[model samples]
Target: MLSFAHINNSIFAKSPPFRTAAKRLFHAALSQRMKIIPISVLEDNYSYILVDDKTKEAAVIDPVEPSKILNVLSQTGAKLTSVFTTHHHWDHSGGNVELVAKKPGLAVYGADARIPEINYVCKDHEEFKLGTLTVTPLHTPCHTKGHVCYFVLDPATNERAVFTGDTLFIAGCGRFFEGDARDMYRNLFHVLMRLPEDTWVFCGHEYTRANIKFALSVDPHNEALLAKAAWCQDKTITVPSTIGQELLYNPFLRVNEQALKLAVSKSDPVEVLNTLREMKNSFR
Candidate 1:
């Protein structure tokens, strides 16, 4: 049994030397003119197209099929400069080889070496350019050891969207396939949750409806969650959930709530999370 007391031994327990907020995202990054186009594929998978309308340059995140991505590129009239792989999962990386084959010298950035055609290995806080916009790769390794979330920022408009592969979803998170509760705790709270409050959450799957169902069962009385659940029923896709919005309703993000702790009969945050994960696994 993994205990919450040993949290520091997990992958993200050690704090990196991150720059101060003012220096990290300079004041100029407020006027970015980028558009996030969500491509629906493989039943519930999502591939995001980040396009710089000004430069006509773009990057694809979590591409699973080439034809689908290609159609978007053709429609947007944007040239593909790179592919950002969030993890080693087939659903997120299946189109890497084909995209690389179609567009030569197209960089594939990922923390996982297992990601197919990964030519650009991303390091923590590694920044790259997609048609003049800045993309920072945040290493959040709970879903899979090398899972990363791409933070796309427009320096001019200061607009942002995080391409969260399977690490963090809309109202839920990825299953603990490679790591444990402690690792997930840091990934969700210590790392990703610390991003700017208004950051757009562009996750890898369309699992909001199901996630909300489970979320309601656990955090049943949240008004924001209840409203969001009602809204989800009428939509085919639920994404671009803001960080501020997630903080209000996501059960995974609210493990510290007194209600959640009591419902799971756990005192420690990690233990509560583990209990939540176990319960949610069989929720249906």
Candidate 2:
């Protein structure tokens, strides 16, 4: 299991600086064929470049900043063959039209027709391939009716990752903007939680610090959450938190627990989740 302590040590063993440590850890962990580059865009949003080393073919997820993504592609020497649009939100699919203009003939995959320049509409639980990597589009509708989280598997080493655009965050979840609490509950518990425990979670935003703050408010005595909160104090990039780690810390994933149920004076998981979302909306 990749604990926060292990992650901290794996990152900062040789270097004291955050950026240097992160870069070293990122490269060191890329022993598998799949390589992920998390690019910061629009202040807090994250755009990822997932590369298949064997084929040198790459796919960009929610590439809001095309210029930044293009620059990274140049450095990696990987061909950008496709775009995985998570939703129809402007921040997620804003660069679709422009990106297609720059690099035409790219397959733009999305579930919503509202997504600009989207050509391939992915169905629920649709499985495809990007090079040797297996891509599964999981339709998680809560933040939006068409929100889809991309679950990718590296068959060579059995490594897994889920690109949860807005449906799921590090220790929190996105607001139920389009759907209700029940939709979010099913999306979180049924769809996402079914993935392997070690599956790395690459969320759409850099909101770990803030999410941890709120998580601690509801589940204050949780040692895992406390450890994560302390680890996040000095960390700027907190992507790639595993599904097991989230189950240990994230309050959203702990709705069935008695502590979370008592936090909002609710026994039913759905009610607790609903109350928790309301509290989060008003928190700080």
Candidate 3:
């Protein structure tokens, strides 16, 4: 299991105040906009802090613990505007109450009406703004029925980052808790795969090492899968894989791959997904 103790220290070290001042002066001198600061949270879950260097306004995504998040905000001196919850799971949404208590009237957004302390209930494709940052909510309900992923488009860089909360991961997809293989297939292949190839994928959880092990079992002939597993072992760090990379190496994503199709003994994509998921569950 991964430890989260280091997360709080890392966020404080990269606080917004330091970045904001530095970015503002740099932007003014160079006539370029500042890049956003992303803070990883929990064991593998990432709770991003999108700060507007021009305005010092900020928003947080899927805060698992409020104390650590609030500490980062306090150190950074960034005004907390809103909280985005990807799902109702305790690991993702447990900090909602305390966070709202700290920042009264703060809007907490989630697709599930069941999310605790949700101030703004969002739907698929609903758009919201925090400072200059615009986020679109995509309702992806495979891990859980109301699970949502937030896609952010930075106006300055035109870069995209998808905050996939539990629905997707580095090399594997989430368990079929509230949904099934078909639900995951559409979410992973249809929705997420449609994004730009370079889009950075920030998923929930740090299961890459274990996920890749399962991936190799399903598709032993994949050279890329073997290499990635070795790389992950060497780093002693969780691999933050991209959507494009997952497409190439993840058996769950590559349901159409011949090796996976043969392993599952099914030509259908959905059946392949089911087989891959069951295989992952059985993996040590």
Candidate 4:
């Protein structure tokens, strides 16, 4: 098994450092566009601060714990200008009212009317801005009828990240609480997966360890799954997994693969996904 450091180094080693002055300058530009700080809250949930370095303005995603979010904002000196709630779940949107009370005039964006203090109810593919970052809200309605995943891009560097609340996780996916397999398939493959391969995936919960365990059970022979398990063993937080990396190990995204279909004795992609979710629901 590879140590955590070795695993990270190996994954990042594919891209060698830039030696040319122009390339170095490009790297610097990429670094300054956006900074994502993951704030762990309430057992396993994650609330994020998306900071646009150029403007010193930030947006908090699923600010479930207002105090922690406020503390980070104070430390970073980034003015909290907006709130991006992925869904109306209490764990994800619980802090909205408190957060708004503390900081007035913060634009609270979401798709559901049930979302606390949701002023800007978003439509599918509604594009908005925060400082230099362009945020596109994609309607992903599996986890909930109004579930949404925020896809944020910094045009300056073209850097991307998605805040997938309960829809998609590192190696596993959320339970089919409100919708069925078809809805989840669309959320995972059709919507979120369609983003650029390098887009960073910041999900709602830090359930990587448990999710990887379940993933390994179904994909025991998968090299990528095994490597991911090893990589996360020593880490406490695992919020940001890239789309490209998820395609390799996430079984939910691999429903079309022959091996995964065989694992559940199904060939049709949707049926395979359905069976996989059922199996996951019961997996210890």
Candidate 5:
């Protein structure tokens, strides 16, 4: 006497207790995955704590103070494995000495000697494993001669993100202090842009609002930029801008777009980048 609908419902439905226990287990499993926590230090700087929850191993990127990082480690119950430095700027490397002093034999990685307490000088294109996560260091030296970006990927899944330390921002790129516009073009377009469009961008600053303002000035007609401006107004959503969204709205990445080219009055991408950078340097 069982109808088809009743049979289907019987097969699919679960008892309340069973569903509750399943939900709890699902949440517990999700919580055990690798996580990236952004710790804002100084005025606009962001130091990240990349933690692999299953193994409870952690790496602090560009720490400004040891106490903040120690606090995170204590909260997560994760042991400090190493520190990743994107560039040698003082704000980015300030806590390196103290962190190493706290965790003796901790491997601090960077591209140059300027990063304090750098025990492991990472080379470009090198891959390092941190628990279930795999990190590839991309040497993007235009920010500084030895600047590098750490690209983190979950080998078992399509989950990937890049830690762009001062080299690239949310809607803008870094100031070309040590290199020319050409270096930036190569690093931003040729190097970083080649990654999957969904790669999460975790830059080193809370400059998204200013950067978006600059972007809207040059690329006003872009719907993505317009929507993003509306969303970003009076709010701080700094980390985790995707490559796809940036390619759509970021003027630095959209140098070849006709609207941005006209705004900058330049045709060549590098020239457009130079013009945009100069404009941003003086942009309110």
Candidate 6:
């Protein structure tokens, strides 16, 4: 019902500039173009709508509810093309059936073979395109064996944004439900940490305030952690921290920090990660 070109143009105009301009200039300059929309759902989950204003085609990520997302598409006048699932968790994938029912023949992409009505099963490092937007799927298996995040490159602004489902949160990581501390360590430090410092992290939940509180207990001497915790308390707002910010305040992500290393009783990155995760699990 919506004009695709109008929606595509709108997103292109709104996309932010690349966080690492210098590093991405060459690669991003030659990539496809697209725009993204983030729709918050289910108290903390964020469902994203990636639309190419020029083509009016759109994709949604981790939709927990359909009505809200459908309304957004209608209001913005964008045609829904696909749905991307990070994992098969109920909270993250519950809306799939309703959405598919509404948009018959719509393709739903996910790494999990167990997800309902999955038409396009994705793999790690797999690439897909919608209009001018190019999305790369990173198979991060800590939260769930098939959990995957989508890295979007918008050529119009030459920027990058990642939709990190449950694998990564604003200032915390997901619980090791299907994987162990080591898997999460690799996912956070080796995989995600390798990205640009300024990459806007559009995570799954709004648990920033509570996560930072626990982080403060782990590293009481961390000025940034304390300050962020206090600010979160004062404003009663969830901090949409970036990966760079997490490196500074998130205990799980800061396994190598001298103070965190000391608290965890280990200098080894993996051990530090394990200790921190254990502490957080018991933390009230």
Per-residue lDDT over 119-195 for candidate 2, one digit per residue giving the tens place of the 0 to 100 score? 99999987999999999999998798989999998887787889999989999999999998999999999999999
Pairs that collide, model 5 = none
How does candidate 6 fare on TM-score? 0.84
Put down candidate 6 lDDT per residue, 1-284, tens digits, no spaces.
11111121232222222211122211223223454556667776777777776687889888778888887777645789899898999889999999899889888999998777799988777788877777888889978998998887666665667889888886688988899888998898778888887666778877878788788787888888887776666332242346787788878888877888888779898888877777878889
Across residues 117-232, which tens digit of lDDT does each residue of candidate 4 receive? 99999889979999988999999997899999999988877888899989999998988888999999988888988999988888999889988888887788999888888877
Question: Whole-model Cα lDDT per candidate?
Answer: 0.80, 0.85, 0.73, 0.82, 0.79, 0.73
lDDT of 5: 0.79
Q: List TM-scores for all candidates, in order.
A: 0.88, 0.91, 0.85, 0.89, 0.88, 0.84
Q: For each candidate, how many residue pairs have backbone atoms clashing (under 3 Å)? A: 11, 0, 0, 0, 0, 8
- Expressed as tens digits, the lDDT of each residue in 60-114 for candidate 1 is 8988988877876786568889899999999999999988888889888998889
Best by TM-score: 2
Query: Across residues 111-192, which tens digit of lDDT does each residue of candidate 5 receive?
Result: 9888888888898889998887899999997879999999988765657779999988988999998999999999998889
Q: What is the lDDT of residue 265 in candidate 5?
A: 85
Backbone clashes (count) for model 1:
11
Can you tell me which runs of candidate 4 are displaced by over 4 Å? 1-31
**Rank by lDDT (best first):** 2, 4, 1, 5, 6, 3
Q: What's the C-alpha lDDT at position 257 in model 1?
A: 92
What C-alpha lDDT does candidate 1 achieve relative to the native structure?
A: 0.80
User: Candidate 6, after superposition: displacement of residue 31 in Å?
Assistant: 18
**Model 3 residue 240 distance off true place after TM-score fit, in angstroms:** 3.4
Clashes of 5: 0
